[model samples]
Structure formats: C-alpha cells, structure tokens
Target: MTAVVNVFLKEGVLDPQGKAAHHALDSLGFAGVSDVRIGKQIIINLETEDRATAEAEVKEMCETLLANTVIEDYTIEIN
Candidate 1:
C-alpha cells in the first residue's frame, strides 16, 4: 500500500517563507501573484493486506509525528 500525506499550515497563520517567495516573484516581474503558502508532502509505502488498517495507521502517524496538530492540518490518500 502507498499512502500520500499532505501537511499544511492552517489558515490565518503567518507564513514567512511564503511571503518571501511572493516578494521574490513580484520582483521578477510576475504580476498578479497575490499570495503563496508552503507545505510538506510525505509518501509512505507499506506492505499491508487491508486498506482500512493501512489508512488507520497512516492517520495515526500523521497525528503523532508527520503533522503538528496544533498549527497544521493533513490529508491522507491511499493508492
């Protein structure tokens, strides 16, 4: 099983890195680039016979280590 996790900061949080990228884009003459936000993605491969088990484990991983629940949100997809 393959699990893909996308972790990102919640809305209303200040993203300094995103702001820097936005400024850089504007300096390079890219107009109308209003905002930018940065996030992280993690892909995990596991040998599992049950899809539900894999999903539950991945969710636990996200909650425990992959994502910061206090300031971030995550979504997981299994393939």
Candidate 2:
C-alpha cells in the first residue's frame, strides 16, 4: 500500500511562506494570481495490502504527528 498525504493551512489562518511566494510572483510579473496557499505532501509505502488499514494508519499518523490539527488540514490517499 501507498499513502499520499497533503497538509495545508486551514482557511482563515496566516501563511507567511505562501504570502512571500505570492509577493515574489507578483514582482516577477505573474499578475494572474490573487491568492496563494502553501502545502506539503508526504508519501509512505506500507507492507499492508488492505486499503482500509493503510488509510486508517495514515490518518492516525496525520492526527498524531504529521500535521498540526489546530491549524492544518490533511488528506490521505491510499493506493
């Protein structure tokens, strides 16, 4: 099994890195963008064959340490 996780700041939260990137884009004349959000992806390989178990384990990982539950939202995709 493989688990793909995407973690990003929740709406209404400040994303300084994203803001800086957006500003730099504007400075470079990429004028179509109005907002920016930054996120991270984590890919994990599992020995388990069951999709449900892989998903549950990844969810636990995210809730426990991979993400800040208070400020970030994470999605897990099992393949």
Candidate 3:
C-alpha cells in the first residue's frame, strides 16, 4: 500500500515562506496572485494492502510527527 500525506498550515496562521514567495512573484510581475501558502507532501510505502489500515497508520504518523497539530492540518490518501 501507498500513503500520501499533505500537510498544510491552518487558516489564520502566519506563513513567512509563503509571504516571501508571494513577494517574489509580485516582483516578477505576477501581480494577479493575491496570496500564497506553502505545504509539504509525504509519500510512504506500507506492507499492508488494506486501505483502512493504511489510513489509520498514516493518520497516527501525522498526529505524532508528520504534522504540527496546533498549527497544521493534514489529509491522508491511501492507494
């Protein structure tokens, strides 16, 4: 099985890296963009083929280490 995790900041959180990217884009004449947010994707391979088990394991991984629960949220995809 394969698990895909997307971790991103929650709403109302500050994103300095995103801000820098937005500023750079504007400087490069991409003024149409009003905002930007940065996040991370994690792909993991698992021995179990069951989707439910994979999802549960990945969710635990996210809660324990993959994502900062206080400021970040994550979605898990199993395949």
Q: By summed lDDT, which 10 consecutive residues of candidate 3 come out lowest?
A: 49-58
TM-scores vs. true structure, each candidate: 0.94, 0.96, 0.95
Residue lDDT tens for model 2, 14-43: 999999999999999999999989999999
Clashing pairs in 1: none
Residue by residue across 1-79, what tens digits does model 1's lDDT show?
A: 8999999999998988899999999999999987899999899998996899999999999999999999999999999
- Sorted by lDDT (best first), the order is 2, 1, 3
Candidate 3 residue spans exceeding 4 A from truth:
none
Residue-level lDDT for 1 in candidate 1: 87
Off by over 4 Å in 1: none
Pairs clashing within candidate 2? none
Which 10-residue window in model 1 sums to the lowest lDDT?
A: 41-50
Candidate 3: C-alpha lDDT: 0.93
